[model samples]
Target: MRTTRRWWVPAVAVAVIAAVLPVTPATAQPVSAGPGPVVADGVTQPVFGYADAIRERIFVTSDVDTDADGALDVVAMDIIRPRASEQGLRVPVVMDASPYFSTVCRGNDSECKADLDGDGLNDRWPLFYDNYFVPRGYAVILLDMIGTNNSTGCPVTGGRADNISAPTGIDWLNGRRKGVDAEGNEVVADWHNGRTGMIGKSYDGTLANAAAATGVDGLTTIVPISAISNWYDYSRSNGLVTRANNYSGSLANNVTNPDRRQYCAPVRTQLGQGGDDATGDYNDFWAERDYLPHAGQVKASVFVVHGINDDNVRADHFSKWWYALAEQNVTRKLWLTGTGHIDPFDFRRAEWVRTLHRWFDFWLHGIDNGIMREPAVDVERLPDVWETHADWPLPGSRPTQVFLRPGTDGGPGGLSVRSGPGNRSATFRDTPTMSQATAIRHPSDSSANTENRLVFLSAPLTAPLHISGTPIVRIKASVDGTDTSFAGLLVDYGTRERFSTSGDGIQTRSTEDCWGEAATFGGYAEEGCYRQTVKTVASNPQELVTKGVVDGLNLDSLFVSTPLVPGAKYGVDVPLMPEDYVFETGHQIGVVLLGSYSGYSSRAKQTRSQITVHFDSTRITLPVVGGRQAAVAAGLG
Candidate 1:
C-alpha cells in the first residue's frame, strides 16, 4: 500500500556532480561533490556535506499589509540546503517561521543575533536545523515572520496578518505565490520537491499550527512543540484575564519594528480594544486567532509535543487542540512530557532526534519507516520514565466523583461520598495575594490565613492512585460581590521527593550529546546537542498536581458574563489542568479552594468578598483507572 523512494543513491550522486558545477560568490561549493567516503547511514560520508551547504535569502509575499501600506507585507526566509539541490537533486523542505528569530535566543547558550546587512538576512541563524537537517538531504528555511526581523510589516501578534504569514511562504514554495531575492530578483523554489514540514517551539510552533490549519498545499506535516491553538486561551482562561491591560498590544509592540511604530499605532489601538481587559470575554479578535475552528481544514498529519506541567503555554492549549484534531480523524501522534515550556530536544535529545528523523522521512521523503504504525501516544510517567499507549486518557478511565464534607472538630474538611446536612457550609474571604504554596501548606491550621481558603483532604491512600485525564471540580457557592474569581488546586500531600515538573521544573545544564553525520565543517563546526537536564526534586511534603480558575461572572458562558446575585447559590464546574500522574500509598489527595490566583490573573485590589461553599453539594471528579480496586485493596474506598 505504501511506496518508498531510494532518494539516498541519487542524493549522493548529485553531491558528486556539484563539484564540477559552477557556483556564484553568494553560494558555497558542494562538499559532497568531491569524492570522499560514504558514512554508515548510507548515501555519502557526511550526507549532504554541511560545510558546503548553499545559503541564500528570499522574500515571500503575505496576504496582509500590517503597516497599512498599500502593498501586501512580505516575510523574509534565510535558506540552508544541501549544495546537491543546485545540481538538480530535488529535496524536501523543513521550515521554522518565528517572530522571535531576532529577539529571543534559542538553545542552551541563549545566543541571539540580528541582521548583518539591511537586506533581511541574519548572519547567524538560531538553532541547529541548518547543521542537522541540511546535511540529511533537506532544505532548512529559517523564516522571519512578517513584522519581525527583516520582513516588511508590523507584528500583529496572533492576529490575522500573523496567522497567515507562514502559510504564505509555503504557498510560494509550491508555486501558488511569488517570492523575490535580496536584489529584488524574482525567485522560485524549483530545486525543492514542494513537500514541506514545519517545526518549532512556542511562538514558532504556534505559527506552524496556524499555518497547517489553513490546509495549505505542499505542507505534508507539522511538529508543534508547546504551541498555542487559540490566542484567547493564551491570554485568558474561562473569563479570567491572565495578564495586565492591553496584553495583545504590548506583545505586538515587543515584536514590531521600532521604526514602524508610528505607522502601526492604529493597529495597536485596535488590538487593545479587541482584547478588552475590562471584561475578559471572547471577542471577534480572539475568534480570528483561534485555530481550533479551522482544524478541520488541516490536510497535513501532526506530531504534537507538550509539557504537561508547562504553565507558560499551559496543557489546555494542547489538550483541546488534540481533541479537535481527533474528532476530525487526523493522523496524529503525541509526546506528553513533564518538563515546563521546554523542547523535547533539550529533555529527550537522542530519542527526539531519532523519532523526528523517522517522522520527517516518512512524510516528506515517502519513506516506509513504519512511524505511522507505532503507538499514537508517548507519555512521561516520572522522571526519565516513559510509556507508550494506543491512545490518550488511557482507554478505560472512568470519572470517579470524590465528594466534600465538613471535618470533625472543625478541622480543615473531609473528602468522601458520605453526604452531610445541606445547610452546612465553609466560608472564606477573597484573598488575591496568597501564593499557591501557602494555600496548600498547613491547610489544617486555621491560624495561617484559614479565612482565605477552604481545604478538603481525602484519607491517606492504602495503594497507588493513578489519575490520567482532566479533573473537574463542581462547587455550589454564593459570593458577596457581583463578580469573584475561583481557583481549584489538586494537590499531592506526601513527604517523598517526586519529580518537580510543575511550572519551570528545575533544569541544570550539564554534559552535551551530539548527533548528525560529522562534527567538523571548515572553521564552523556543528554539534547537534544540548545540555542534559534533570527534574527538580522537592521534599516540601506536597506537590501541586493541577489547578484551574474561573471568573464567577462568566460561569455560564465565556463570551458573555452575567453578574451573580449576592447570597444566591450557583453551581459552577472548573476543569483542572489535564494530568497523567500517580499518587503513591500513604499520600493524601487534597483539594484547595481559593478566591484568586495572582500569578495567572490581573492584580486589582478590590473589596474582599466572603464566599460560602455548600458542603454536601461540592464534589471533585477525577479520571480514575482501576482506582476503586486499588482503593478497596488499600482499605480506603
Candidate 2:
C-alpha cells in the first residue's frame, strides 16, 4: 500500500506499453474559439504530441468518436510548462499518473521507477522515460492513467468510485484541449484557465485528495503523501484487518488482479470490493469516500505529507487529515517524518522537494514568493531539532498536567513524580521489569523482558522552556485484556550535557496508531487509562507558515544548542518501546509501544514483543509554554 518492497509478491504484474508517444504542441493559453456555443463535448480528438523522449513529449488525446466508437479511444499527457521568466504566472497544473512496473514487471531491487523528486533518486519522466513525471517548472499534466507508456485506459482503482482513476485523471486534465509545454511551447493559460495543483505519493497521493473533492476545475492545491483516507481505514485498525503489511499488500497486489485482455474491466472493477456496501461504521459510504467530509469540498490549498514511522498510512492517517483540515478552515501544509514507509529517504526528501517547490511556486505561480508568509507548521525533530510554529495548538498553549509516581527503582531512572489520581499504579496485568534487549516475537524469546516504563521531568528551566506544542499522556490505564495498545514519548532532557543533534534524524519514535482507541464503554478517551496521545509534533510552527523558505534552517539558539552548564537539569525522556526498539544513546528519546487497539491489547500485533508491565497513575498533559512570553517564539525575548 505504501512500500519500496521488502518481499511478498503473490501476484500483480501487468502494465506495459513502453513507447509510442510523440506529438507535443498544445501548450496552455489557447482556447477561445468564440462566436458559438459548444460547452461540453467539443473535444472529439484535437490535442496531440507524444515524443516520449528527446526532451519529452506527452500531451495526447482520444476518441475515434468516443461514443461513435470507430475504435481509436485513448488519451495521454505529461506537460509541465511555466517559468519561462514568469509573468502573471497563472500556471499550476500537476497530474502525474504513477504506476509503471515496466512490462508485466521488472525493476525493484531498489528501482521500480516513479521517483518524482522523492530523491531516493530516479528520473526518467522527461528524459530516460521511467516517467514519474517531474519537469519541475510547474504545469505538469501526465495521464497514463492505466494504458501505460503509450496511454490508453482500463486500469482504475482510485476513490469516489465509478471506476476511479483520479476522476478519469480529473476528467482529462480539466476536460481537454490545452496543456502542452515541454519545449513544444504553449501557455498563456488554458488547462482550464490555469491555477491547478495536485501531487501524488501513494496511488498518485490517493487521487490527489479525491480530485480536490470534486470541486473540479483548476483544483488549486493538494499534496496527499502516503495516503488513504479510508478503505476501511485503509485496511483496518480498530476494526482489525491488517493482513501482514506493505499496506495490505498494495491493496492486494498493484490493485487486485485485472489481467485478461492484459488489464481492463475497470481493472478488476476499479480495484475489488466496492459492493454489498463495504461497511465498518463511519457511514455515508465512508462519507463520500472519506477525505474528511471532503475537507470542505477542497477547492485547493491543502498540503499533508506524512510518515511518522508509517506502518502503511498510519500516522493516524496524518491526524485524520490534520483534524479534517483544521475543521474546514482548510489552509494546511504539514510534512512530518520519522521514515518507515516512503517520504523520507533522509534529508526528508530534500525537505520534501523544497516543500514541493515553494508550494507550487506560491499557489500555482502567483509568486509574490513569501509562500503565504510561512509558519503554519514544520516539525522534524528527534535526536535533532528544527522547530517552527505559529498555529497548531500554539496559541497560548497550556494543558499542563504531569504525574506518574511509582518507581521504587524498577527503572526509568528510579521514576517518581506524584500528584493525582493514584492507586500506586500498575494494572495492565502487571508483570514487567527485566531488559537486556529483546522484542520481536512470533515464537521466539531471548530473555529481554521489560516494562513499567514511565519518565517525566520539568524543573530546570527558569528561562529556557519552549515546548512548541501538542504532547499529551494521561495513563490511568487498566486491562485484563479486551484490546489495548499504547506508545508515547516526547523526550528533551536539555542539560545533563551532550550537545549537538537538534532534529530530523529522529532519535526514538515509533508510530502506527500510537495511543489506543476502541474500548468504548465510554471511558479512557483522554485522561489516563492509556491516554498517551501526541498526534505528531516534534516541532511544528505550521511548517513555518508554509515552508518558510525551506524552514530557514532552524536550531535557533538554546544556549547555542543545549549549554546550560549552570545547575544543570533539563530532561524529557518518555521511553516506552521495549519490545525491541533500539537506537541506543542517540541521547535517549524513545517511544515504542504496541499491542495497538485500546484500553489494553486484544489483537494488534505487528510482531515485536517485550511484555511485562505495572505502571499506574501516569499523567502528562504538557502543552506548557512558560513565561517571557514563552521565550517569545524562541527568539528568547
Model 2 lDDT tens row, 1-637: 1111211111221011001111111344444332211112211111111222112334334422212224443444544343331333222356655544333322111222243443322233321111211222334554444444444444333433311444444444444444334444532233233455666666556767766766665566778777766554555433333333323224434532345233344334433444212222233333445666667776566777765545555556666666666676666766664443454323343354445656665555444345455676565544224466555434555544445444343333222233533445432222222121212111011121124333333333334443433444444333343222344444433223222223322333232221111211112111101111122234421111000000000112211122112222112222221110111221222122223322222223332222223344455444445523543322222
| Worst lDDT 10-window in candidate 1 | 1-10
Q: Which stretches of candidate 1 lie over 4 Å from their true place?
A: 1-46, 113-122, 258-263, 417-423, 448-450, 501-503, 517-532, 602-605, 627-636
Candidate 2: residue 257 lDDT (0-100): 31
- lDDT score for residue 574 of model 1: 88
TM-score of 1: 0.89
lDDT of 1 by residue, 200-277 (tens): 999889999999888877777899999999999899888888877888888877776667677777888888998888
Best lDDT among the predictions, by candidate number: 1
Query: How accurate locally, in lDDT, is each candidate?
Result: 0.77, 0.39
